[model samples]
Target: MTTPVQLYVYDLSNGLAKRLSLSLTGKQIDGIWHTSVVVFGREIFYGQGILETRPGQSHHGKPLHMIDIGETAIDEDTFNEYLAEISQHYTADKYHLLDFNCNSFTNDVIGFLTGGSIPSWIKDLPSDFLSTPFGAALRPTIDNMFRRPIPGAAPTPATLQPSPAATQAAVNASPNPALAASLLQAVASQAFSPSASVNGTGSSAPAPATQPQTSSSTSTVSAPVHICTNPSSFHSLLRSHRAVIAMFTSATCGPCRMIEPVFEDLAWSKTHGVGKDRVAFVKIDMGVGLGSQVASEFSVRVTPTFLFLLDEQKTYEFKGADSSELRSQTDLLLFQAFPPHPHTKLSFPAVEALSSEPILFTQVPALDSVISKLASFVDGSSSPSETVAAKEKLSQSFPVYLKARFPANKGAQPPKNLSANPQLIASWAEATRTIASVLPAAQLFPLVDLWRLSLLDQPIATWCSAATSQTNPVHIFMSKAIDALHTADMSARNTVLVTLRLLANATSNTALVRSLLSAAGHRAETTKVLVSSLLHADASVRTAAASLAFNVAAYLQKGRMDRLRGDSSAAGMEVEEDGDWEVELVSAVLEALSNETHSEEVGTSFRAAA
Candidate 1:
């Protein structure tokens, strides 16, 4: 059953604003509007990040207007996920009174839930208030009320850190608390000042700092981790790390100077970010006081010598400064230390060679054509009032949002580093649902096509992948196309074509592939859809279905390979005993092969799946 979505509009100024607005601002304002979306039996509002309470239980007290916006097709989980994604932009530091205030937030939420904007009066109130002479004067005061300092608020160049995602992932996956904490510090340092060095690369170094410190408390820059100066500190690092590479050098050695920069780069690239607490790079100068002791203990005869230690034992030793050999040995050791899954060795050439890229339908059509199609669906007199409201809001807003996100020069593809604007995408999701519930099967292609391209954006793809089947836009629409197939309405072929391509594109994300192929209900739904569509009367539907089938097979093959290779983090984490899906998939492909006549592409896909 759909949940009824309500807008709880509160007056922040109590009754005083309504009474004093005419005297203060020369125009009568209803209230200093603060709104929350009331759905799933909870009232959600944005303030110091997204917050929730029992409806009418917030500090703002009971709402003045409990407006019936519309019912939402999305469940609590999906709505909450949407809130989390959007909340990144609505932090405490981002809040403003006249601009980006509570009303602005509610408008976004209302659009997502109902594909309808908030009441014009409430939305226009801030702009209307700002236009007044008295209200204009208070703008700076209002801005100051919300403005606050944020630590590490400045953007850092991304190239400083080797791979932030890899570093964070390693940290989380680490079983050792002390190691996790150490890696966590590295991540924090990178977060604040990515360009800052973690460990000192100077010839005469000091002991590494336990934690990074900046010049000032609020400074964006952070100090680098100093290289170990004494034998005691060197031994401490060796004990803590799984692998340690100690470089013995002297200030007078020209080769040492030549290789110092390379070592420093490796230290930052390997230890600070990607490898977590696994490997450490140490530099010691024999010319320095404590460095002579370390050099003598390691038995270094010449300057610019390297020792690769694993678990405190010297595994490999080399002399002279050959950067190429140093890199090769470090890579080899890292590989030996953290091996890839062995299943990667077993090559089934056809399926293995299949492109891992999600089959994206990225062709940009004229926006007018899409809007015109939507217009046809909603322009009818029989359309529901809520649908009409949603259509109006969507037609006005979506195209503008889409163009801004994907400019004309960029050719409508998802832009690099797409800003986190969950509300606009959520609004589109709701609008699609609003139209899909009423539009005929034949009319869904255009809307589905729009959604297909939108999924190329990582955030949107991630959100949809993480959503439940009931709430996943891809699944809901794909199931619609599958339902249409039961009626054998050939007119719905184009709808099926795009829907299949949408599924293929959605699988571009690993999480989506896991959801589609590993979850039992979703696996069954997808398998049935593919099997049924393979025998469709239209060759395009068959071909699209075949391509989707190939993607599914490739995903399963990858999972099996990962499992065989003993990768604990593989998407197919389930036991091999749950091979029922594999059997079913193989059976379906074989059946398709038996009956396939047209489309060489279909046969190619079949070969790949096999």
Candidate 2:
């Protein structure tokens, strides 16, 4: 449902001078009042800021004007946290008579909450009041009026409001795994809180998406907003995030600076509401961030220019600094790009509530002995010698230093730091990184299979942070498997491919696969590996490759491979007309379908790919 944010306009002067002030300046008088933002009908940050001056007297005795600033991208919990962060800057100490006051604080809150600034005149009233010689003379009196000491009272900011730019991290790391994940899921799915416990062991079966999302909460990107302060990042942004709002601004432009608050307000301060997928807001200061030639490539001569793009195609273009219109049109652009999911009808309350209850992977991880034994065979040097007898003894005793002990419950306590995997996962990645060159081609696939199982046992939350990382064991193992998929031994090749297929089924998540492929630092190459594996001689390997392809295609269906679709050459590979390897992979699946009619298993996998 569309939940419009509430904006409160309080008239401090109560219209007493509106009739008189209009005659003085010939401008319409809207009364002198305080402005504030109220979410869900309660004002937590403001109103109290202005209470010292107005008390019970200057309410205007009128119904506070409420302006709907479109649907909120924040939930109540996150909204409360965000209020706290801005409150640091909007403290009572920061209030000024002619510079920063109630109106300024309200504008800040409104911008933070809904990414829409309050009315310009409201925000400028104090400055406008001071500009007048009469009001300038009265500034001291007004300041004294607001600065009056409260009788036996404390400060408001000392008590309420703040965001740490880390709500996602908090949610991901909640003590109650279900609660934290439900909180995030609530933003998108609006699901109710879930149970803390999960049942069943891990298998080559897809875990439920709405289970206790505790495992995956271990990973998080601090903030979604990427400040595009330069050209290279801007170019990269163009290729990623299916839906992007590019606020083209300049340092010297007055209006651009004016609406820059809008950038601060609407940026990724919040990532809930209708949809978080493929939606990104980027601020490109064209003057400083993009050079003149590069700016011309985007054809930006004007400041405050906005480009609304979906799937790399421009959907809307406009030049304006009007914060409201900019926001409304951006909302419209998000609507055009990502329409509301059909699930918004409120018909499935049970299902909506269940969206937070993710079933975690509870299967026991592989024993250290298995990993140690697997490492033993592949730990040998590339050139063998009579010293093999001595080397075998050392390899036998070699322990797998990169083994982690996963908890039965993902949200049990302090979550494991896959990002800061200084030992186990890092050692695993190092072993996989050089193992291919060290081990014979025939044995590489079996070694990779063991590595895959070791990683597969890791909770999805361990590897899938909100960042692109290859240092994690899951990524390194996949990178190693990319080599194993092409080994000369059909048995080893099929084993590695089948293991990938099994892992894909075990966790039907896009973040895991994307993170794995993201390890190689190039999506096209990893994609090529998945596609090239389809041409393997063994039908089962090809089928497993196809199954892996099918699994990843589900990731594509969700727009996870935004990196694969870009302007760069495909590392000298053949480019399709549209230049998406995703298309080529799909075509390969179809071709395999035509040639292979015998195996029911391969056909079923191909059908899933189709």
- TM, every model: 0.46, 0.38
Per-residue alpha-carbon lDDT of candidate 1 for residues 8-114, written as tens digits (9 for 90 to 100) = 98776666567645433335677767788888877777654456666776666677999998897878887766665454444444344555556656766765666
Worst 10 residues of 1 by lDDT: 215-224
Which candidate's lDDT is highest? 1
Clashing pairs in 1: 198-225, 199-225
Positional deviation of residue 536's Cα in model 2 after best superposition, in angstroms: 2.5
Weakest ten-residue segment in model 2 by summed lDDT: 188-197
> Per-residue lDDT for 210 in model 2?
23
lDDT tens digits, residue span 191-261, model 2: 01111211223122321222111111111111234444334445555564677877776546677667766
| Candidate 2 backbone clash number | 18
* Candidate 1 wrongly placed segments (more than 4 Å): 1-261, 267-305, 309-313, 319-322, 334-370, 379-383, 399-423, 437-443, 456-472, 479-494, 507-532, 535-538, 552-587, 598-601
Q: How far is candidate 1 from the true structure (C-alpha RMSD, Å)?
A: 20.8
